[model samples]
Target: MTAAAACDTAALTAHLVARGLTASPAGVEIHPLAGGVSNDVVAVRAPGLDAVVKQALGRLRVAEEWLADPARLDTEGRALRLAGRIAPGSAPEVFDLSDGYLVIERAPDSWVPWKQQLLEGTADPAVAGRLGSVLGAYQRATADRDDVLREFGDVTAFGQLRVDPFHRTIAARHPDLAEAIGHTVDVMAASRVCLVHGDYTPKNVLVDPDGERLWVIDWEVAHVGDPTFDPAWTIGHLLLKTVHRPAAGAGFAAAGRAFLTAFTESIAGALPIDPAQLVRQTGCLLLARVDGKSPADYLTADERPRVRDLARRLLIDPPETITDAWELLA
Candidate 1:
């Protein structure tokens, strides 16, 4: 069945029952969840089941006509399973993966998305520190695993969802920087360092209200590629937030520094991270969000050019350290 047709709540309920994930469809509360731009997400609550079910959309919900393989769902499931094994509680428990649908444990109500908190101007350094530490551990644990390399070697989804939309799209728009952007693409394509969560923005990170636990969600674009992509993606979002809410820029910058320090310290001895590569990727991502298929909605019209100029400057004169990139906003 087509992805659009399969998004029906009734159809999804039936699929869950057939897959033995739910005992019955009766009294099951299936409500749609927001914050997703490429897939259908529903919160399923039944007599004894409380989970989030996701079905990948062949055509993403973007103004641009973007298409991706539904098989990315399988990759997400596999990534979640691996993350659970590598760092238990860092990712939701996958209850079932059938066809193109995935049902995973739904986080508690108190666990809010870090993006929401950031938008509300509550910049918590602890959130960044936790994410850095967890992601670093995952990458270190899964590093050099040939089996994982083979399983996630296909960068089709990552290319379609990330590289094509963000890096390539921006490169086409800014022809002068095409060489630099293309170079990063080629380097990322050739590198097989560790598991890269292609989309590691704040929106995908969930933090408990009490500030004790955290979970990283949305691994649809996960792959085995450049280790810097995840951290770069994350810091890029924080930079955008800094531009969007300048009043909270100082706090956001601090969070970025904390996250970078924690991440670098966590993987200090296990793997070597190139500071220049991280800043280069960060520059590419900063430009992508401002002038790519999916632009950041939070930035104002006047604010976009500021980001554009900063991105270009960074690309031309890349920083030697991640902290130096943060200092650009200062």
Candidate 2:
């Protein structure tokens, strides 16, 4: 193996040994786990055993200057357990994890971050629909548990992520965009309560090897907020794909529409929410990218002038219909 890959294996084996999951290094093998912005991951292999080990770092790998929260590491485990509880196998099973190291059963297949797949036109719309259902069901199951969620009126954490950095910085940097962003700030600050995967986006999901099942990963950003928040958050990424990758934009838009139709239809009458509100939330979700602290992925990239246009439009002049807005992918 290349020296870098070998080093990754050795490092992870040492970590697993320290975690007491593996006592010896002789049988264990490691493969570098690829993807994501905030974590370092390695896949560990042994006879009749397969799992992934993830660790949190102070800075992102792609841009070593950006700092991130270690407390969010603890959130991953909480999210995994909560997801499994809501849907028996919506997430992979974890054998053991601590503040720094997390070990969980590895899905035995090559998978693409749903963002990459969507950008490539290979991601399935059915999976998007399932994602909606899974998220919706999870929210409905926890909606009434006030004891489970201590706060409903505040968004200190949300402000830290969506407001402080992403949205606020843009307005501060671009004076012309201030008025549009100001409006989004008010909408985000007025959020409702429901279980939210704060970072609900395509990059965090993996399709089962057989392509029949879908799995959502990364729960470090889970919070209790408006019920339709996750849908708006996810659909925003699909909207992003449409703007950034011309070839895959059509597929991404199709998935967003299908996912929304399925999500709203599945929860019809059962939900107390209005679809228009969700659409408004989506515009706010898009604005949060510009006005919030954790900016969308496109903001960091050098190319794609259209994404800048879309972001401005979503914030400055959002479409009246989610479907009409979704067609931007075409």
Candidate 3:
């Protein structure tokens, strides 16, 4: 079915019923969920199901005409199932996957997106640590697995959702940085070490109010690629938060540090993380958020230039370590 046609609530409800996922179409309630630009996400409440359904969009819901394969929904469902097996509770259970829709366990109402919590000036170091550990475990468990590499070899979704929108967009905007950005892109494309959560940002992580449970969601871009990509994507967001909320910079910086420490510690001896790649990727991400197709809404017009300048510095004179990069911001 066409992406536009699949977005129709009545059509979606019919599809669910046809797939036998819903017992009745009359009582099923599907409401759109906020904060997704690449897909139609809905909270589904029915007689026997409380789940979230995501339908991948061929063209993203952004000002730019960003396009991607709707088949990436298949990748996300597979990744969630694998993650559940590798690290139980880290990712939601996939209840169903058909057509371009993925139905998975819904997070409790008590759980809020980590991005919301971070934006509210609440930087919990423990949350960062937990994210780091869970991600590390995922990478470690899936690393060097030939079966996994075969299953997730396609980088089409990652390219469309991330590399094109962020790295390539930034490169085009800043001609001088194109060479460095191109090199980073080359390295990431060539590397096939482990499974990478291509969008490992705070927005994708859901946390309980009491900080007891953390669930990583949205694995549509998951692929077997560079290990640094996940950590870099994550730390880059924390840095952006620091810039957006300067008053809470110290707290954000601490969270970044804690995240890196826990991440490195968790993967120690299991997989080696390249400091240079991490630094370069982080720099690319920093620039991307400012100049990419989907710029961070929180960054002011004036703050964008500062971010661009810092990103350029990091790209040209790459940091020796993640801590050094954080220090530059500090």
Candidate 4:
């Protein structure tokens, strides 16, 4: 490895050795994995073990102010553990964790981020369907699992994560967004309950090179409450991504719709939420554009005309069908 790469790896290996994941003189080898906007992940090879070590830094390696979140790393271990329980195959076992570090089983280095595949025009929607199916199982299994899901209950404070930063901070700086976003407090208060992956976009998923199973990662903002948490998130990102890359986006949405439709059907009997509850959740998803902390900076100036237009129609005046809401994202 190069010196800069070593800079991100050796310190952690030493930390792990002290924690008993590896022996002090075991001749460990480390390979740093780089990509994504907010993490430092590395592959570690030791005499008795092979593992992927990851850490979340407070500031993004990139200079985007909206990407910064100091509290994110602390939520990693809990989210991964919960995800492993619900969909064991989707995540590697969590071998160890501390302050800002996470260690899990090492998968093939050939893993491709679902986003890059979509951009390159090769992502499979059927795999996304399986993702949706498994996520539905996760919700059903964990909904009342000894209140474990409920312990991570701060998702109700979504107005803070989803609303204030965009409205009070970023969108407030722009005159165009100012009027529509002004006094947006009441817009979020109603539907602020549910266990949501708060950042469940495609950028957070990885597909094994064979184009088979999927792995969903990055759960710093995950919490319990809404059934629409995962689906609405998937829908909105689908709309945004599709608008950006027409062909791949189209494929993603078709697969997403299939996944979500199946997921809803599977969990219909188990969801504690009613129509009013889901409607409220969908509305909360709409405000995600104007009031969300990170906002949707993933879109371009040309795309915002469409995204913002959809956010307003949906947030301010919603349609009856959840499918109708998806078109805004498209």
Candidate 5:
């Protein structure tokens, strides 16, 4: 089945029944979930079944002509399972991995995205700490593992979804910073120490209403690569939020620090990456959201220049730490 066709309720329901994931479609209800540009995500609820079905789109839902491999569904399925084992409840359980889609455990109805909370100026440091712990655990457990390398070593999907749109596209647009961006890209491509969640932003993190447990979604870009990518992406996002809402900068900064402290502690100081690397990655990510194929919808016209200016500075002369990066917004 085509990715485009999989978006329909009828097609998804039929797919579920054919896979025997659902006993019957009698009382099943499927509704499309909003947000996300790369995949068609639907929430399927039925008798004793609560799941999300996602199918990779060959072309993303963006203004630019971004095309990715539909086989990324297979990658996400494998990565989700591995992530679940590594972090234990940090990722959704994979129920089925079919030809073109995945049926996975869904977050509770009350669960909301961490991105939403951040946008509302509710930056919880504890939540950041938990996210850091899970990311550190995932990278630490999979670091240098031959089995992990063999299974997720491929960077094809990562390049298509991340490097091309964000890094490469941004490089072409910013000629002066192209050298710096190119260097960052080179370093990322050379490093293959652990599994990198290419899209490890707050938007992908689902927080339970009670704020006790959280789940990280969207693993289609997961691969065996630089460990810095995941942490940088997460920290970068916190920094982005700080820029977006300067009045609430203290909260976001606190969360950034909490995440770094917890991440470092979780890894037991074994994986020491140059702080500059993270600065560069964060800069690249910030610039990507403002000018790359997928712009940050939340950023306003007045905020775009601020992000662009900060991104360039981050690329040119990176700060000593993510905390320092937060200070730039002030």
Candidate 6:
């Protein structure tokens, strides 16, 4: 199938009208949402519709020449529906999925990216806990389900967007850690446990300040694979924030604890995999952000080595649990 045209206000407006999605397409306003690199996401407002339309890009908007199948939009549409069932209101509701584009529910206009909140140092424990609960519920509910596995079994997109750009790229750059990173990749490939939100970072989450609603957006990389990847991304990102601002380390550490505690509690049993696996994944994730295709823009030149050193230590001598990983921040 041919890929759709790149998403822009004018093209999207015509697409919506052509699909008979709105009678007053003239009044339908589309504004591009910033912060994503792999797709064009826009907020749409019409006479009776308030939604977000997303179309995948084969070549991601990063400095590196990263590429993935745009058909992953179909995977996202399916994942959103399933996640909405597992953890209602935690993900965007899919409305239409076709022609290599997706239309889905939009968070309230007032809602902001959770990344913004963390960057500003709010570090609300409640928000952190809720994120843990949602992720935990999604993983626990779908763990080892054959039907889910059948639908989301593919990990090609995950490889392109995550494993390759992250694990492989970093391994090449840091050959000293190649053996350990290779094992992590092998273990992840061998797993068929649950639905992994491959991009479960703060930037993908939207929240309302009133403490009322939270939406985990961007499921384009969702796949059924290693369950540890989601929590690793979350904890890894919090660790990044801690590294970014050591002055607010205490609050960030508290949020990480709350997140991990809620995740384990939501499982309501022994952790599915060894806790050490979480640490290992977090270590790899840390290395990826600092040296992989997309380094964090927030960190200063002096801070990059700090992050690199932390990642190296984590890989060589990993902490036993996610909570223990925070001590390395010092």
Question: Which candidate has the highest lDDT of all?
Answer: 3
lDDT of 2 by residue, 13-127 (tens): 7777767777677799777767566677778886555898787766665432456676666667776887898888778888787747778888757755677677665758888
C-alpha lDDT of all candidate models, in order: 0.88, 0.68, 0.89, 0.63, 0.88, 0.86
**Regions of model 1 farther than 4 Å from truth:** 1-7
RMSD of 3: 2.2
After superposing candidate 4 on the true structure, give the runs of residues whose Cα lies further than 4 Å from its correct spot. 1-8, 60-74, 144-146, 155-194, 272-298, 325-330
In model 3, the runs with Cα more than 4 Å from the true position are: 1-7
Could you give candidate 3's per-residue lDDT for residues 212-311 as a string of tens digits?
7899999999999999999998899988887788788888888988998888888876877888989899999999998899988888988788787778
Candidate 5, residues 1-330: lDDT per residue as tens digits? Answer: 456555477777888888887789899987788858988888899877789989889999998799999898898999999999988899999999987879999888899999999999999999999998888898789888899999998888899999999999999999999999999999999888888888999999999987789998899988998878888888888877877888889999889889988998898866667687888998999999999999998899999999999999999988777678776787
Q: Answer with 2 or 3, whichever has the higher lDDT.
A: 3
* TM-score of model 4 vs. true structure: 0.77
Q: Order of candidates by lDDT, top first?
A: 3, 5, 1, 6, 2, 4
Point out where model 5 deviates above 4 Å.
Answer: 1-7
Worst 10 residues of 5 by lDDT: 1-10
lDDT of 1: 0.88
Off by over 4 Å in 2: 1-15, 18-20, 62-65, 150-162, 245-250, 268-303, 327-330
* Residue 23 displacement in candidate 5 (angstroms): 1.9
**What's model 2's TM-score?**
0.81
Write model 1 residue lDDT over 1-330, tens digit each, in one string. Answer: 356544588788888888887788887888888858889888999877899999898999989899999999999999999999988999999999987789999999889999999988888998899899988988898788899989888889999999999999999999999998988888888789899989998999998987779999999988888999999988888888888888998898899988988988887668767777888899999898889999888889999998898799778888777667657766
All predictions: root-mean-square deviation over Cα? 2.1, 3.9, 2.2, 4.2, 2.0, 2.7
Report the number of backbone clashes for model 1: 0
| Cα lDDT of model 4 by residue, 231-254, tens digit | 666666666666667767567667
Better model by lDDT, 4 or 6? 6
